[model samples]
Target: MKPHRHSLYRTFANAAAGVVHAFKTERNMKIHAAAALMVFIAAALLQLDLIRWLFLLLAVGLVFTAELINTAIEAVVDLVSPQVHPYARIAKDTAAGAVLVAAIVAVGIGIGVFYEPIRGWIGSLL
Candidate 1:
């Protein structure tokens, strides 16, 4: 029998598994994914330029990173406390707050990037 391979590929595979787990188990992640898909489709339909696309990608990355970190923090807090505790609550709340901040920033970026184009499209419909 052949032994298992250990390489950078394995590391990335494990990382992808974590992302899949998050998407499967987290409701917010699913929402984020749907929003991302919508943004990409809208961008394509609107013929958004490269710079705007880059900003949108950065916003998505920021939101996903914050969400994953928040999940990690919550898991660690739960593992350490396992019961109701003020510090655990504080830690979890802070992590969730970070996700909220990231999400808000992403919304700002999306509005900045898409608002004018969408507004123009709506005006053209009249």
Candidate 2:
């Protein structure tokens, strides 16, 4: 069978819908979004250099991408194997692990980018 085709608008709308669904249903998505907001606020306050800003943006994107993929994997596993199964459990758990790894990397990037500015800001306050 030939593959189905979608209009550009439809493709974008579907992608947006997935993002909305994840944010609405996934607790982790909310936490990531909140953390991202705080990071941006701090970056603004600190006047991050362009390179640092790019790093922060990439880190945030990585976390978001990982989380979205994890959510998709969980949904597929649930649909394919609704009953409890070892393989299904493995699939879901590993997908979650990916998110954990991404979050850790993002944290490291945040610390690397923020450490100097935060330290200086604190020093100036004292």
Candidate 3:
């Protein structure tokens, strides 16, 4: 006999719940959420062009997605290897590094996109 399989809707609902749980349980997800909100505000205040906004949103999405992937990787690694192991450590570290790289790139993009406008605003006041 085969084990029961969930319906499509049930699978989707489970996936959605996992995402919500990841957001709630993961500290980095909270940080990403905050950064995303900041980027949205900056986009509005800076009056970004459509193309700039698109790039900004894409960068933000990349960071968040990378973070989620990293969290999932860490969780699975922990589940599989509860005991301390060098390879498990390496796997988690590599996943974290990916997130870090994505975050750094996102920051670079944000600075590049917003710096000139922000500098001009300050220059006008000063």
Top candidate (TM-score): 2
lDDT of 1 at 30: 93
User: lDDT scores for all predictions?
Assistant: 0.94, 0.97, 0.90
What residue pairs are clashing in model 2? none
Q: Please report how far candidate 1 places residue 20 from its true position, in Å.
A: 0.8
Q: How does model 3 fare in lDDT?
A: 0.90
Q: Candidate 2, after superposition: displacement of residue 11 in Å?
A: 0.8
lDDT for 81 in candidate 1 is 100
Tell me the TM-score of each prediction against the true structure: 0.90, 0.97, 0.87
Model 2 error, position 61 (Å): 0.5
What candidate 1 gets wrong by more than 4 Å, as runs, is 1-6
For model 3 the TM-score comes to 0.87
Sort by lDDT, best first.
Answer: 2, 1, 3
Query: Which scores higher on lDDT, 2 or 3?
Result: 2
Q: For model 3, name the residue pairs that clash.
A: none
lDDT of 3 by residue, 41-110 (tens): 9789878889889889889889888888898899999999999999999999999999999999999998
Give the per-residue lDDT digits (tens) of candidate 1, residues 5-88.
789988899999989988998899999999999999999999999999999999999999999998888889989999999999
lDDT by residue for model 2 (1-126), tens: 989999999999999999999999999999999999999999999999999999999999999999999999999999999999999999999999999999999999999999999999999999
